[model samples]
Target: MRPAVFFDRDGVLNEDDGYAFEPSKIRWIKGAPEAVRAVNQSGYLAFVVTNQSGIARGFYGEHQVHALHEWMAAQLADVGARIDEFAYCPHHPEGTVTEYRQTCSCRKPQPGMINELSKRHSVDIHRSIMIGDKQSDLEAASAAGVTGHMFRGPDLKEFVAPLLKQLPRIR
Candidate 1:
């Protein structure tokens, strides 16, 4: 099974602006590409898991989200980094949009996203890690049985290098 490096889209990969959707609005954080590339070079699948409550609030549609992802991918590719997959939870328990206002397992703190990926991709949960700026991300990682890294600044390398060293070498 392959090890994975799961990142939270809003804060870890790009600048967090509440519920982001527009490609033009996306901003890459410092060390973002380098961190992603490191994971790739380490033979880890870099996946993005995001909580987009804006969709639930009727701020954007799925098409917009997909477009944003395509744009993000292009941007990452430019830096010699690529995201393997992107997963998101668009539902909001108290969403104003009726269709989106439902409690779902895919939401963070539930581990549904990681669980789905683990099953479908044959990922080793113990060898994976989740990086994000929110506590929810850590909670989800813990629930999924993966190491969690909380990101508070722009430099991800500083946060990740030591942790990466601690993990058993893959090669």
Candidate 2:
């Protein structure tokens, strides 16, 4: 099993513009793509775990989120970076949409998505890390038995560089 770097989608990878779903509105955070590429280069699989509450709020559909992720992947590919997988929760307890209104374990602050990813990808929980701009991201990482790093400001690559060095190299 390989170690993985779990990332939160909204504020970590792109500028969070209040439930942004449009491709035109997608703005990469400073060195976000490079940070992902660095993880790839370091022999760790990269995965995104996001809470897409807009889908449940009726601001957008799930298809829109998929489209946006697809666009993001294409953009990252242009920079020689790639995301191995994406896990998102489209459910919310107070959602306006009937089908989406439910308390789900996949939401942030919960470890459902990370746990699922670990099962699917054979990820080493202790060796993995999660990076995000919110406390929920750290909470989820802790729940999933992985180390979490909170990213507040500065370049994403610069923030992640030192931590990457601490990981044992895969042989």
Clashes of each: 0, 0
lDDT of 1 at 129: 92
- For candidate 1, write residues 57-121 as lDDT tens digits: 99998789999989888888998988898899999999998999999999998899988988889
| Every candidate's CA RMSD | 1.1, 0.6
- Candidate 1 root-mean-square deviation in Å: 1.1
Model 2 regions lying over 4 Å from their true place: none
Candidate 2 CA-lDDT value: 0.94
Per-residue lDDT, model 2, residue 89, is: 97
Model 1 per-residue lDDT at 69: 89
What would the TM-scores of all predictions be?
A: 0.95, 0.98
- Candidate with top lDDT is 2
Please report, in order, the local distance difference test score of every candidate based on alpha carbons: 0.87, 0.94
lDDT of 2 by residue, 1-171 (tens): 999999998889998888989999888889999999999999999999999999999999999999999999999999999999988999999999999999989998999999999999999998999999999999999999999999986689998899899998976
